[model samples]
Target: MKIAFVANTCWNIYNFRKGLVHHFLSKGDEVIVLAPKDEYTDRIKSWGVKWLDTPLEGTSVNPFREFKYLLRIYSIFKSERPALALTYTIKPNIYSSLVSKWTPTKVICNVSGLGTIFLTTGLIGKLALILYRQAFKFSSYVFFQNSDDRELFTSKIKVESYKIGLIPGSGINLEQFKPLAFTQNTKTKFLMISRLIIEKGVREYAEAAKAFKDDKNVAFTLVGKFDTNHSRSIDEKELKQWITNGWIQYQPHSDNISNIIESHDVIVLPSYREGTPRTLLEGAAHARPLLASDVPGCREVVKNGYNGFLFEPLNSSSLINKMKLFLSLSIDEKKHLANNSRELVEKNFDEKLVVDAYEEAIHRIIKVS
Candidate 1:
């Protein structure tokens, strides 16, 4: 059987769905990927699957461009006619499922998060909800990363309850992210890894870091690339100002994330919302404590005061308080938090669980077809 995985970027599919893709390929199923070409595109193609470049403008709302995107997806579905299509991100989930209605393919949409659209009250939000409802009507299944998202979609968009399923946000690979030895350093290190975007709480993180600027024993590091294309992106000027102020140490995005996570004592994410953040899961897998906003996807990973702390979203003072609390912890207490982080990932967010879920869904689709 042939299966297709579609998303906005090859980077997303490569990082999040590679395990599932490998699972199907190992079982003798032909796997194809449809996403925009990026540095990871060649890497994914090297896995012995066909790669088709499907250009997408993620944040654009122009009707003509959207129509062109839809037509491109329709053409792909009509030509390739895969047995099953698993889609991620907003555009692929919405457009691919809509195309599936007229094609021989069956689509399974993954609702990673509500994103900015569902968070606001506007005409665009209403129109997006309508599109989701119509597109999901043709989808074979819709998997949500968190229960909060599932409830919201069901309540607001009225998707069929029978078609809804919940899975951990692109489960973490435990073997790949083995816990590192805990070493007490002279300085306590705190790190936040995310795109430099306002919605991700970059400003909050910087402000919180400022509170610790005078402390010689504390260090704060921010790792991620500046996304100039995103509307919510933090501009280079703001980032430079933060660096000049010596609030936090900034590092450009690195492919060696595990190495960076191992070096940090604690991981922090102050984002307003998320669809299961991979960084938190990766941090936990490395036996690093977490400090994140008490938002939906983050709360599911951080059991406040267990594996880590949860602060108020978008509140710099709240984040500063949490950092102070962490700084006050004894070495043993810090180690306990780190241990619990690894234990939580083992119990709930192993990559095997995600692979199994996808395999089961694939089997059901094949049987039906």
Candidate 2:
């Protein structure tokens, strides 16, 4: 069987969905990635998967560029005609599904996150909603990361409820992310891992970092790509100035995500919204307490005082308060939060569950093929 996984970036496929890709390959199915090549493209291809660099102007408003993206997707699908297609992010999901009806491929779309477009009702938002309705009409199944997203699509896109499935946000491998024995670090470090985008609350994080610059017990670190082309990206000069003033230690994006989490006492993501934050799941798997916004995806991860804390979505002051509270925790309380985080992951977010569900779905398509 030939299976194609599509996303906006190869890094997304490499980071979030690699476990599922490996599962299919282990069963003797050929896996191919359809996305724009990035630093991780060659690395993922080295795993014996094929790569096709399908480019789209990520934040462009030009219709000509979008039409070109559609044609490129259709050309690829018409040629390869994979047994199945799994698409994440907006453009891939929409364009791939639009072409699936003309090809033999069965389409499954994962609505990872709604993104900033849905947060407003501007012209672009209206256009996106129209495109989604047309594209999703061709999808064999639509998997949403959360129930909120499913409901929104049902009401807005008018897609049938039966066509929608709920999967945990790109599940975490329990065995691989097994908790290391709890060790106390001399300085309590808080790490925020995400794209340097305003929607991820990068601005709020920076503000919080600035407020706590004088604290001796707390240290803040940030790790993720600085996407200059993104509409919501933090200004390069501003980000550099933050690091220069000793507000936050910045690390270049690296493949060693597990090690980075291990070194930090707590993991934070102040995202404005999420499908289900993979960061929180990974952090919990490492027995690190989580601090995140109380939005749909994030609140599900942190159990208030049980495992970690949650603050108002865009409130830097609220974020600062939570940081102070974390810093004031007793050693025993901190230990309990770490244990609770790991326990929550084991009970809920295990990667095996997600893999099993997808494999079953794919097998159904294979039988008829």
Candidate 3:
């Protein structure tokens, strides 16, 4: 069977969902990659998957541009005639599902987190929900990374519960991210690995870091690059100011995420929401304690005084309080958190679970369709 994975960016497919691609290929199924071409397209093609470039403006809300994107997606599906279409991110999920409705392609939508528009109570949020409701009602299946997201999306859109599936975020390769022994130092290092954008809770992280300015021992660090094209991006001038003022140490994005994790003590992600926080999985795999917002995807990772602690969303004070609690932990307490972190990831969030699930879902869809 020929299967297609539709996403907004080829980078997302190559980097995040590579395991799932391998699963289909290993099963002797032909896999097609569809997304806006970038540097990673060649890399993805080298993996033996066929690439079809589908142009899109990821951050745009303009209906005219979105309509064009939708039509282009429809044209691709109409021509390729894939047996099954698996879509990730916002544009691909909705637009691809819409196209599948008119084609023989059976679409499986992966709700990889609701982006900025869904977080808002304004016109954009309402508009996005309406579109989601329309496209999803016709979908073959809906896969959510966490139950909270599945419940929220299905409740709003009225989809079949039988059609809903759950996956741990694209998932973390335990072999690549397995735990390393750590020792506590007088200076507790806190690190946040994320794109520099507002919705990622960058501002909240910055504020929480600022609250610890007078603490000479603890260091607040951010690792990841600025996402310039994204609408929720942090202002370049302000980011520079944060660095200049010595509020936080900003590290450039690196290919070796495990190396970056090794250099930090505690991993933090105060994101407003997520499909699942990949960084937390990476950190936990490396046996590092976590700090995250007490929201959906985040809560799935942190089990309050278990693997790590959870704080109120958007509350810098709450984050600061959690940080303080983490710092005050005895060596035994810290070790307990680290042990739990590794155990939790090993038992639940292994990357194989996600890839195998996708393969099974695609096979089942093909068998029944």
Per-candidate alpha-carbon RMSD to the true structure:
1.4, 1.6, 1.8
- TM-score leader: 1
* Best candidate (score: lDDT): 1
**Deviation from truth (RMSD, Å), model 2:** 1.6
Considering lDDT, which of the candidate structures 2 and 3 is the better prediction for this target?
3
Instruction: Give residue 125's error in model 3 in angstroms.
Output: 2.4
Each model's lDDT: 0.89, 0.86, 0.87
TM-scores vs. true structure, each candidate: 0.97, 0.95, 0.95
- Candidate 2: the clashing residue pairs are none
lDDT of 2 by residue, 27-57 (tens): 8888888998788899899999999889876
- Candidate 3's TM-score: 0.95
Ranking by TM-score: 1, 2, 3
lDDT of 3 by residue, 1-369 (tens): 888999988889987988888877987889998899887899899989999988888767888999989888888788888888999887788888888789999999988887654687766577778888899877888899999888887777888877889999978889888898878787899999999988789888999878888889988899987888976789999888878888899986777888878888899999999889889999999999999998989999889999899999888899999999998899889989998999999988999998878767766666843
Candidate 3: what lDDT? 0.87
Model 1 compared with the native: what TM-score?
0.97
| Off by more than 4 A, model 2 | 121-123, 363-369
23: Cα error in model 3, Å: 1.1
